[model samples]
Target: MATTEEIEDLIARSALGDRAAFSRLYDRTSAKLFGIILRVLKDRASAEDALQDAFMKVWRHASRYSANGASPMTWMITIARNTAIDHLRRRKETVDADDAADRLVSSTPTPEQSAVAAGEARRITACLDELEQDRGAAVRGAYLEGRSYADLAESFGVPLNTMRTWLRRSLQRLQECMAR
Candidate 1:
């Protein structure tokens, strides 16, 4: 790994469109960056994907990095972590009733175990059921899938403003429910 001063100097040159400097920076940081992504994603393929995306970001955003603030490695690690989280969120979008059923069926439970899970699920269901159906759906779609409101609006076939309203209202309702 390059020393901190060396990495910062490379970042400065990279910002000036020096490809060789950027390549050296990549060589110095890829292992640490991969490690950070792997910790968040817990899947080798996903971690590799995140690492690639993060380096692309580094190449583009090298000008924004500063030695006085975070070290280049830390900045790179943050990029990797965010990218992995984004991948996980996007991967979750396919989850819905059918998928949930499949997940439940794949894991059989003893009677006592089933009862405990049922009780917790019942409470959660009751709280969610209190919200209007659309509001509930909006909250679940955003929270569980980590999809943006814009994406949900497109999926819901509603206007973007309407989707925003649904999300805002849904959050308020959930807050009120949880408060009690």
Candidate 2:
């Protein structure tokens, strides 16, 4: 792990367009940053994508880090966190749009559609039941009750990021269970 001063120096050099400095910075920090993103994203592929995006932002915005008064690692973590959250928000929007389209096409479900929906609901419930109690509750609060992350975090008496991690992991578990 790079010391804060070393990271800061690398950020400074990176701001000056030193590709080697940026590469060193990445080598020093990518694992930590990727872990942070993975906690938010759950999916390794999406976390990898977010990590790449975060580094691109870091390269472009290194000049702003000093003025922001955060340590280099802190600044980089913020970038990674925000990038993962943005990815989640975009995914939610896309899901919402798809759901709306599905609704418009199926105001009244046929027998087959109803049966499929019932099976899906049961499968989701079974998956939720497989999770630890609090994780399952957090997943339900976030999805079924339409609770915001902040709201769920506060209710659960955990940090916002911890809440996100719980939900992400829970959802991943649910996905796996449903696939079976």
Candidate 3:
């Protein structure tokens, strides 16, 4: 694997429209980025499409990367993730309106029930806030958004096991906080 400094340098060069640098960066990072897209999309064809869209964005937006303040890999992974999410949203928009209406009708809660749910949501948010910011965000991504551990690891630039450990510890902390 390329070191962080090497990746940063490659990104900088790519920002200057150096095709060779962009090629090198893609060779080094495509697998990890593809894994992230696949986790979000859960279909090889859709993931491949999303990955292509993400790299196209990277090619176009590399110059803005440094100004964004994210580490190079994180910035790229965010692009891939957002691309997959946008694709999913577009797919969802194509769902039959009748199905959506049925879902809305079946899922509506009474005002009293909504109040209780809102209170629970507030408690959960408070507990999440008590954790470190990254941990809290990871928890939200995994549980709320259904992101896989592999995807979270790639996005956070951590090893899979390390991501799992972070989540395990964070969940324990959240459980403790919620219990209180």
The list of candidate 1 runs beyond 4 A from truth reads 94-180
* Among all candidates shown, the one with the greatest lDDT: 3
**lDDT tens per residue, model 2, 51-170:** 998899888888777665444676787777777766776666653222111111213446676566556656988788889999998886654334678879999999999988888888
The list of candidate 2 runs beyond 4 A from truth reads 94-147, 150-180
Write candidate 3's Cα lDDT for 55-146 as tens digits.
Answer: 88888777776665445686787777777776765675553322111111223456676566555555888999999999999998885354
Each prediction's RMSD to truth: 16.4, 18.6, 14.9
Ten contiguous residues minimizing lDDT sum, candidate 1: 97-106
TM-score of each: 0.50, 0.56, 0.56
If ranked by TM-score, best first, what sequence of candidates would result?
3, 2, 1
lDDT of 1 by residue, 56-114 (tens): 87777777775224445656666666666667666766532221111111233566765
Q: Backbone collision count in every prediction? A: 0, 0, 0
Residue 26 in candidate 2, Cα distance off native in Å: 0.3
